[model samples]
Target: MSDKRTVLVVEDEEMLLSAVSMEFEDAGYDVLCAGTAEQAYDLLRARPRVDLLFTDIRLPGQLDGWDLAERARALQPDLPVIYVTGYSNEQPRQVAESVLVMKPYRMSAIIDVARRLGVG
Candidate 1:
């Protein structure tokens, strides 16, 4: 087992996922990349030590990022989430201890967030 803090990134776009995964990895996190809420749930359930969640509001499946965060919170209540989307004006509701970061964001900003959250 590795000591690197784990961050689960749920994004539908392949390019976005790859880019974000690389950013997190470079920031020293063990990133778990998933394309859907269900897949994210599986990764979250399987890995008890996932330190943070950086997910997109929209996803590939029926369940959205909110659902993913809810399920993940059930497994790990203290999980810190950052929702990334293009429409930052449409504020999210019922999010627990989260940050809404707009898309077209600097990857370095996300890395800074992870560091602040103590996730690698």
Candidate 2:
């Protein structure tokens, strides 16, 4: 496996996915892009070395970000996660303390959070 820290970015929107992937890459992380929950799962299953997971709260398929986070946590408890959302609705109480980044966040903010979490 490569030595660089790997970050998995899960977002359904093509443009947003590309943008976030670029942001993480620019911040000196090895980025893994997944457009759906299933793809994220596949990536995680196939590549267990991922250090960070950045997922959108509202995904396109049957499995949402919360579900994906739970599953990923089960697979690798040490993995850090950051959830991104645009809505103001109540988030899941179980993972309330998990890192969250509001939509339209700046690259610096994302990098700061990743640094704080010791992921970058």
Measured by TM-score, how close is model 2 to the native structure?
0.92
Best by lDDT: 1
Each model's number of backbone clashes?
0, 0
On a 0 to 100 scale, what is the lDDT of residue 113 in model 2?
86
Q: For every model shown, what is its TM-score relative to the native structure?
A: 0.92, 0.92
lDDT of 2 by residue, 59-78 (tens): 88889888999888888887
Model 1 steric clash total:
0
lDDT of each: 0.86, 0.85
**CA RMSD (A), model 2:** 1.5
Residue-wise C-alpha lDDT for candidate 1, range 24-116, written one tens digit per residue: 888788889999999999988887578899999888778888888988888999999888888655558546678878889999998887777
- Name the TM-score of candidate 1: 0.92
